[model samples]
Target: MTEGDSPMSSIFAAMAPVPERTIADATTLDAAIRAADTPFVVRGLVLDWPLVQAGLKSAQAARDYLAAKRKDVAFTVSVGEAGSNGRLFYDDAMAMNFRVGRGKLPDIFGHIASIENQPDAPPVYLASIDMDGFFTGLADENHVDLGDRDLLKSIWIGTRTRIAAHNDFPQNLACCAVGRRRFTVFPREQFRNLYLGPIDNTPAGRAVSMVDFHDPDFQQHPRFGEALAHAQMVELEPGDAIYLPSLWWHHVEGLAPFNVLVNYWWRDTPRWLGQPQDALNHAIMSIRELPADERAYWRDMFDYYVFGDPELPRAHIPEGAQSVLGPLTADSAGRLRGFLLRQLSK
Candidate 1:
């Protein structure tokens, strides 16, 4: 049998690994970013980063490096109960299992350090901390130059933890700055099989898979077994990184006692085009509850106008009169936003 087609008993063990590449310089890394269409491990891409070097020495050293970069910034940190066992998720009542508290970088780092070797340590996750916002010169000292790409650089610092499988809208390059991390990924097509949680209410900003990666209850979520068939797994050591294309679901695990991850997020589209999630939400509110036949008609309309050929309109109408049906510009996008606001206000 092909890899990732293993029997249920040895599911993770026989899953396919993400392709690996050894990148040595900025030019090669930039090219990889431009060409990436799937998830792949970029081995030792950030091996020379100061923070990674510190982490290679010891967890304490890694913490010290982060502490030194503090800029008197207060960060919102998530602290899960011991019972949660490092999974930042929702409780039985659908309330979040973790509580957020504001703290400085050093205090958060110190808290993570205190529980480094403790048994059953409560999960202390300071996730998605904006590197430029929280730390002074940290981004400059420890980052890969991605050429002209405008990136949202974020850092995740935590104890041994598991982030539920989630997909972000932007392409991601995740660097393992300290400790070890394992990523189990599934492509966008597996959305139906993943058993996603509520879009409106989420543990984090994005809707995540309800399936527990550590001990997946395949009986309850039978389709999850189907998702594993397309899964790819990779373990990243300190200084290694992985590139994941947009909207690919990934479940992340911090395998070591203390871990720090730096991730870069960017979209290929222009900033003014707006988010696709917003469009999905609007459709759900306006179109989801419509009559079946009407919904089907609207689906056909969407297929013809949005997803199908752009040149199809030119044959039926004059080019200048095409209006919103034609190519969209930043200025036109602003006007379209205004038009949407007017329609919504009614």
Candidate 2:
């Protein structure tokens, strides 16, 4: 479709010079992060870091390795972005060339070194830095008291693909190297201006696609101009990193081939109390338990809760009811589970 075709999207361009480069020292990073109000630059984010160094070496070898392994491999597909389940090759668009799963070499994608040597060959793997190691480094850098930040749940994704405008789930510390990547961030409050795409397209259910930055079709989506008034953009290379708060809408893309990105993702700290179900789970509960009439009511309720409304309590919630906000311990979790279980249980 056309740029900014959707009315629910917003765009952010490089509006100012970034914060220049630094060693990403813990003390320096803590301060520099606050100054990154707008999209800014942080050079050498993770180039020398041992984690990224090895991944780049791995990506370089993928060129010849994948050629021999492609016969048995197939493109990994999500529900929507990969086409109507018929697209050729996986979504290597800009992902790092690397492997996944057990002792197997994955059909990774990266910038092809030369065509003369292997003209028909595909790009090699890139962006395969150690996920857990990256986060452990962040936890140490921030001194955030991450009780379990070293768990193996870490994930490092590459293949230079466009991650449309969407909020991240876990807290994110995206460290880059080798090549460059541009990250455009809009405030959480500006979700309205961002014409979001279909959520089912991504595994995380994020809204894919974003409003074009340079030349948006304002005629169709005139409201998107508001997003320009307040936006942030950053270009990250080796040794640079950005602290992405939980659930802040961000649009990210790889600017070059063979770029390296190592992100440290950690779940939010557990709270003392309150129900802790996420928006998606809560949504399923509303849809399944509530009748058609009630379900419609819930749609507006969530819009009011998440969008805008007076019903949202502005005052502090009493400490007693607050414990319900913790997903693992919240009574709402049990209720939500029971609500869904009734249907699945049948």
Candidate 3:
């Protein structure tokens, strides 16, 4: 059988080993993708058309076209490890979803879609694209040639290829053409449960999929509850996609031997009232400019908001007061923290 036709040889194949699931019902796929926590919710989501017909019905034809147009493909700028940096993949790492300006994209993998023959390489990240420039055109309807946007950023995600837990910058709609996929989602609050890989927003691909809900070792990750309570997941078939919110952690797997998918990356509204704090730059500044003790203090201070517990981590100013904390309250800590935030923003 040709690579595309042998849909069961993938690691996530029906024959492959997996944890027993308690998932019930076999109705709407979107519900499973959004609410499934245990194997308890195993079903199908039959959406995304051009993909299913083109991939499953005419596998050979699609593969032939994909192979011939390899050079025309211009994505695969490794954001992180499909293994090592799986966490980064969680947040709109899929090239297509990002409403990126031409200035931001690096075109790292180049547009040539190479039919990967290397055993070391995976096939699940096989075929995908963004077409951001294409959509932007619909709004303005200007003379958008999509010339430089010619780079086809598709992932030939090999089957059994697993991506770690993480969320995208926004909601993503993915369409599978030839194969099927599985996704597990953790809401934004579950960031701690996921043993995140890197601070660099982009992923170079990673080995570990985010949280292992199948048989979680709660003892090892005590704080994992923050993730467990908000879990959602699903298995995607040809022509199906999942909509994931920003900061939500998710693990993904290519279920079929020959998997082909197309996803759109879109952003959610900004989280902060003002521009996002340049925490990275601050981290660098602390490490470089401060003495060792000062740096450590700042590090802890940073943790108070980013990693510290939710109840009383750091402080923030109230909405409409003259006090540094915005509004004055009986709590002095909040004011002090607001002062610090102001200092940081400056």
Winning candidate number (TM-score):
1
- How would you encode candidate 1's per-residue C-alpha lDDT over 1-346 as one tens digit per residue? 2123424326677899999987878898888777878888988889999999999999999889888888886889999988565789999999999899998878777788788778778999998989999889999999788888889999999998889999999899999999999899999999999999999899988999999776778889999988999999988999899999999999998979899999999988998999899999999999999999999999998888878897785567787887777799898899999999999999
Winning candidate number (lDDT):
1
lDDT tens per residue, model 2, 70-117: 333333322123211111122445331222332222323322343213
Give TM-scores for every candidate, taking all chains together and pairing residue i with residue i: 0.94, 0.57, 0.48
Give per-residue CA lDDT, model 3, range 1-346, as digits (tens): 3333433234224222222223233333335435633233212233324335556665444454444333443444332233321222344453421122221112322221232333323222432443343223211211111222222333343433555565544445454555676766666655666766554443433223334433446677667655645555566666444544444566766655456655544333423322233555456656768788888887787676546663343244334443432322435545565766898798
The 10-residue segment of model 2 with minimum total lDDT is: 79-88
**Sequence-dependent TM-score of model 2:** 0.57
lDDT by candidate, in order shown: 0.88, 0.48, 0.44
lDDT for 301 in candidate 2 is: 70
Ranking by lDDT: 1, 2, 3
Q: What shift in Å separates residue 10 of candidate 1 from its native position after superposition?
A: 4.5
